[model samples]
Target: MSASTAVEKVNLREALLTRRRARTPAERESAAEAIALHAAALPALARATRVAAYLSLPSEPGTGPLLAWLAGRDVPVLVPVGRADRSMDWVEHTAGAVESGPLGVPEPSGRPLGPGALATCGIALVPALAVDHAGNRLGRGAGYYDRALADFPGVVCALVHDDELLPHVPHEPHDRPVDLVLTPAGVFRPSRDRDV
Candidate 1:
């Protein structure tokens, strides 16, 4: 990435984070519920054989509701455990069996299924600060998800607030674009003909 692009990304990330932090707890909860409803009804999700998802941070769109919904449907959910090399190991999501991992995100207490575990998943629900109509997602700049999903063949989806669905965001070649963006309002396909 160019120096100018890097600087722009830094500024944009901070602005988005500020907006997210300004939201009320109730607003966040309501959005989460709406997002869950929309995600649960996704056609791709209904056909998924396995799913990869993240445990959202307090500032990000909460995944707890959707996670619960998936569990209720008997969907096997794989959550990420960040590794030292910035890649992620997938583990089965087990409620109440989580502890903070290397990245300070909640991780499943079970043994990791390894990074290649994502190969078995049909879809991945990821956290994003903002995403453009083209599916370019703006994350926390850690490059964790970007690296993890670099070679993933499944449909990659990003979860964000309704307003975070933007017209554009700074991105680089290493920044993996999502196939779908799920916000509180609805789901958007960045590419109409994108193969699920």
Candidate 2:
């Protein structure tokens, strides 16, 4: 990225993180429920027996209710295990499987299914600070999700706050665009001129 774009991304990340930190506990919980409700209604989730998703950090949209809802429906979910190299490993989500892991990210303790297993997922629910109308995602400055999903074919959705769905975000060639963005309001498909 050029110097101007790099500076813009840093400032945007800071602003978004600050907004996340300011959310009250009750507001966070309510938002999580709303997000899960909207996401669960998707035909993709309804048709899938398995999905790839993440257990959220406290500062982001709480995914606990969604995970539990998936489990209840007998839809097994695979969560990302942060690796030393910043690549992701997949772990099957079982009851009470998540624990605090590297970089304070919530992780599953089940047997790893490895990165290649992502191809089997009907849809992927990823985490992001913000996403643009053009489908550019602003992750937490780590390329783990982008690298892990380099060639994934299924629909990829980033869970973000309603206000986090911005008009634009600085992106590079290495960035992997998402097919959809889920927020407390509903599911939104970024308006890309061409299909990803």
- The candidate scoring highest on lDDT is 1
Which ten-residue region of model 1 has the weakest summed lDDT?
187-196
Runs with alpha carbons beyond 4 Å of true place in candidate 1:
none
Tens-digit per-residue lDDT, 98-119, candidate 2: 7899688889998998889898
lDDT at position 20, candidate 1: 92
Task: Please write out the lDDT profile of model 1 over residues 135-177, one tens digit for every residue.
Answer: 8999989998999899999999999998899899999989999
Q: Distance from true position, residue 26, model 1, in Å?
A: 0.4
Q: After superposition, how far is residue 56 of candidate 1 from its true place, in Å?
A: 0.6
TM-score of each: 0.97, 0.95
The TM-score of predicted model 2 comes to 0.95
Error of 2 at 29 (Å): 0.6
Q: Model-by-model lDDT, in order?
A: 0.91, 0.90
